[model samples]
Target: MSRRPFLTLPNSHFFLASRAAAVVTTLAAALVAVSVSAPALAQNTPASSAAAVTGGAATYDTAGASAVQPDDTNNFDARQKDLDRRSTDNNYRYAVAEHDCYSKFFVNHCLDSARNEMREKRAVIRKEQLALDDEQRAARAQKRDEQAALQRAQDAADAPQRAANDARNAQAYQDKQRQHALDQAQRTAEAPQRAANEQAYQQKQRQHALDQAQQGIGASQAAANQKAYDQKQANFQQQLDAARQQGAQKAQQRVENQQHFEQKQATAAQHKADVEARQKQAAEKAREKQQQQLQEQQQQQQQIEQQKQQGK
Candidate 1:
C-alpha cells in the first residue's frame, strides 16, 4: 500500500493475464453450449440429419433425372444409319476391287505379274469348264444317233417274221371253213347219188376251199405284208425323225462347240494380247524406273559435290 506503482507489476504481466482470461472465457462458452445442447442434440440428431440428407438426396435425384431426360433414340438411329452407309461403301469398294482384279484379260496378266497364284487356277478352271461342256454335247449327240439306228435296225429285222406268222394263221382258218362246207354238201346229197355227188361235191368243195384258203392266205399275207409295210413305214418315219433330231442336235451342238471354241480362242487371244501388253508396259515401266534411278544418282552426285564445295 505505499505509494507504489498503481499501474500494476509490468506491461508484460498485464498482457499475459488478459490473454489467459480470453482463453478461459472461450472454453467456458464452449462448455456451456455443449451442456445446453447435449439432450437436444441426442433427441434431434436423427430427425435433423435425416431431413437434411433427404433434402440433399432429392436434389441429387432431380439432377440425375434431368440429365437422363434428353432423348437418345434419334442419335442411336443416326449412328446406325452411319454404320450401314459405311458397310455399303465397303461392299461397293470390295466389288469394284474384285472386278478390277479378276474380270479382264489385262487384269490376268496384272495378277500374274503380281504373282497371284489364284488367277492361274481360275483360268485353268474356266478352260476345263468349256472343254467339258463341249465334250458333253458331243457325247449326247453321238449316243442319240446310235440309239436311233439300233431301234430302226431292230424294227426292220422283226417285220418279215410277223408277216409269215399272220399268213399261217389265215391259212389255218380257211382250211377249217372248207372242211365245214364239204360236210354240209355231203349231208344234202341223196343215198344212191350220194356217193358220186358227195364225192363230186367233196372234190368241188375241196377245190373251192383250197382256192378260198389260197385267196384268204393271199389276202392275209397281203394284209400282213401291208402291216409289215406300215410297220416299216413307221419305223422309217421314226428313223427319219430320229435322224432329223440327231442331225439338228448335232448341228446345234456343233454350233455351240464352235462358238465355245471361238470364245476360247478369243479368250486365248485376249490373254496373249494382255500378256504382250503387260510385257510392253513392264518394259516401259522398267525404262522409266531406270531413267528415274539415273536422274536420282545424278542428283545425288550433284548434292555430294555441292556439299563438298560448301565444306571447302
Candidate 2:
C-alpha cells in the first residue's frame, strides 16, 4: 500500500489534465453556439418589431423600393379621394361664388369664361352624341320630306287627270240629255203635224162625196131645167172640190211649219242644256283648284314651322 501511494500522485495529475482538456473543448463549443445564436436573434428581433409595427398583416407596396408606412399609404389614398371630391365640389362652388370686388362686366366675364370652359368640355362629348342624333333625325326628316314630296307630286299629277275625266263625264252626260230633249221635241212636233194632215185628208174626202150627191140631184131634175140645174150643180161641185183640195194643201203646209218649229225648239233646248253642263263643270274645276291651293298653303305652313324649329 505504501508503494501504491508513491505512484498514485502522477495518476491524479494525469486525470486532472484530461479533465481540463475536456472543459476547454466544451467552453469553445459553447462560445461557437452563442456566436451563431446572437446573429439569428438579431435577425428575428427586427422581423418581430416590423410585424408589430405593421399589425402582422401584408400590404401592397405602390412605391417600389421605398419604405412605405401603412398609415401613410392609407392616408395618401384617403387624401387623394378627398382631393377629388373637393375638386368636384369646388366646380359647383365656383359657379356660385360672387366676385363683388370686380366690375360687373369683369365679374360676368369671369363667370362666363369658367362656364364656357366647362360647357366646352361638355360640348365636346355632347357634340359626338349630338352629331349621331342629328344624323338620325335628319335622315328621318329627309325620308319624311321625300315621302311627302312624292305624295304631293302624285296628288298634283292625279288632279289634272281627275279633272279631265270629270270634264269628259260631264260633257257626255250633257250630250245624252241634249239628245233626249231633242228626241222629245221631235216627237211632239211630229204628233201635231201628223194629226193636222189626217184631219185635212178626211175633210177633202167629205167634200168630194157632197159634190157627187149634188151632181146626182141635178140629173134627177126635169129635162127642161135639167140642163141648167146640171150646169149650176156641176159648177158648184167643182168649186167645192177645189176649195177642199186647197184646204188640204194649206193643212199640209201648217203641219210642215209645226214640225220645223218643233225641231228648232229641240235644238235650242239641247244647246241650253249643254251650256249649263259646261258651267257646272267649270265650277267644279274651280273648286278643285281651291282645294289644291289650300293644300299648298298647309305645306307651306309646315315648312315654316320646320324652319322655326331649326332656328331654335
Candidate 3:
C-alpha cells in the first residue's frame, strides 16, 4: 500500500501564542517606525520635489535667479551621505527580516513578502531624499535672493557716504599739492634773504671783534669790550640757530603732511579695489551657480528618460 506523506503542525496553543507574539512585535515595530518617519515622509514627497524643480526651471530667466541656487558639489555630497545611511538602515532591516522569515513555517512566502516590503521602503526613502534635496535648493535660492536685496539696500544707503569720501580724498590731494607748491616757492624766495642774513651776521661779528681789539686803552677796558663782543656773538649764534631750527621744522612738517596725504590716498585706493574684487567674486559665484543648476537639470532630465526607458 502507498502511503501519503503526513504533515506535522505545532500544537494549537503554541501556534496561537507564537502568532500573537509575532503580531505584537510587528505592530510595535510598525508604530515605532511610523512615528519616526512620519514628519520626514510628510515634508519630503516626490510630488513636492517635482514641483520645486518645475518652479525653479520656470524662474530660471529671472534676475538674480542664479544667486538663489548654489553649486551642487556640497549638496550632492550630502545627498550621497544620506543615501548611504538609508541604504545601511535598509540593509540592517533586511538582514533582520531574513533571519525572522527563515524561521517561519511559510519561509518562502515570508521571505518574498519581507524583501518586497524592504524594496518599497527603500524606494520611498530614496524619493524622500530627492525631495529634501530639492527643498534645500529652493531654500538656498530664496536665501540668496534675500541676501542680494539686503546688499543692494545697504549699498544704496552707503552711496552718499562713499561719494563724500571720494570727494574728501580728492580735495585733500589738491590741498596737499597746493601746499607743496607754496612751500617750494616760499623756500625759493627766501634763498636770497637767508644769504643776506648770513652775510650781515658775519660782518657784525667781525666788526665787533675788531673794535674790541682796537679799544686797548687799559687792561680793564679791553676786558669789558671783549666781554661785550662775546655776548653779541652768543646772541647772533642763538638767532642763527633759531632760524635754522625753524626752517628745518617747516621742511619736516611738509614731509609729514605729504606722507599723510599719500597714506590717505593709498587707503582709499585699496578700499576701492576691495569693493571691486568683492563685486567680481559675487558675479563669478552667481555664474557658477547658474551653470551648476543647468547641469543638474540636464542630469535630472536624462535620469527621467532613462527611467522611462527602463519602465518600458
Candidate 4:
C-alpha cells in the first residue's frame, strides 16, 4: 500500500485528519492547562519531610509523567510531600474548573468534562500513592525480618551460658530443698519430746509454788517466785523462737516452689479471695472478743474505784 501525503489525501480523508488534529491539539492544550494551573494553586510546604525513613522510593507509571519527579530512594519523604502538594493542587484546580463550568451554556457537559479530567489526574496520584505504600510496607517488613534474625542469632549465642546457669540453679535449689525437708522432719520428730519436757518443767514450777504457799511465804517471796516463773517462760519462748528461725529458712527454701505454684494459682484466685474473706471475718471476731475483754477489765477497774471512793 502506498502512503498518501496529508495534502494529497481525498476530501473526506482530509476532513477526518483535520478533526483528528483538532482533537490532539485540544488534549495537548488541556494537559498544558492542567500543568500550569496546578502550581498556581495556593499551598505552603513545610521545611522538613516526615517520610525520609523510607528505604526506596517507587516511581509512578508513565501516564503520570506530568506528576512531580520522585525523589531518590532515601528521599521518599520529599516525594511524599510533592504528591500531597499535587493532590491538593488537583483538588483546588478541580473546584475552580467546576465553578467556571457553572457559567458555561452547556453547564452539565462542561462539568462532566472537568470532572473526568480531575478523576484522571486523581487516579494517577492514587496509583503513585499505592506504589509508595507498598514500598513502605516492604521496607518495614524487611527491617522486621532482619531484627528477628539478629535476635535468633543472639539467642543461639547465649544458649550455652543460659543452660549452665539453669543447671547450677537447679542443683542449688535441690540442695536447699533437701536440707529444708531434713530440718522439717527433725522438728516434727522432736516435737513430742519438747512437749514432754515443757510439761514436766511446768509441773515442777507449780509444785515449787505450792511448797512456798504451804510454808506461809510472805507477799514479797510470792512476788519473787512469780518473777522467776515469768523469766523461765520467756527463756522457753526464746528457744521456740530459735526453732522458728530455722523453719523460716525452710520457708524461704520453699519460696521458688511457691512462685511456681502461684503461676498455676491464677486459676484459683477466686478461691484464694474467698479464703481471705473468711480469714478477715475470723480476725474481726477475734478483735471483737479482745474489745469485750478490755471493756470487762475497764468495768472492773471502775467498780474498784467506786469501792475505794465509798471507803473514803
lDDT of each: 0.48, 0.50, 0.66, 0.63
Output the lDDT of residue 220, model 2.
49
lDDT of 4 by residue, 1-312 (tens): 132232332447676567556655655676576566554332222111213212343344333444444355445676566676667666656766766654445656666777877876765565456455445545665776688579668868987986786677667767877987897799899999988998998899889889999999999989988998899889989988997897687687589676775564554566657866885796687568657645654664465457558646
| Candidate 3 lDDT over residue span 107-213, tens digit each | 65666777776766665555545655676777787899899899889989998998998898789778878987997899899899989988997898788767767
- As a whole number from 0 to 100, the lDDT of residue 16 in candidate 2 is 55
Q: Where's the lowest-lDDT run of ten residues in candidate 2?
A: 45-54
Candidate 2, pairs of clashing residues: none
Which is the leading candidate under lDDT?
3
> Native-vs-model 4 lDDT?
0.63
TM-score per candidate, in order?
0.29, 0.24, 0.62, 0.40
Name model 1 segments beyond 4 Å from true: 1-227
- Candidate 4: 10-residue stretch with minimal lDDT: 41-50
What alpha-carbon RMSD in Å does predicted model 1 have with respect to the real structure?
40.0
CA lDDT, candidate 1, residue 104: 36
lDDT of 2 by residue, 41-124 (tens): 212211111111212323222212123355654343343333233333333333333222122334445546555554443322
Cα lDDT over the full model 1: 0.48
lDDT of 2: 0.50
> lDDT of model 2 at residue 148?
58
Tell how far residue 309 is off in model 3, in angstroms.
4.2
Q: Model 4 Cα RMSD, Å?
A: 30.3
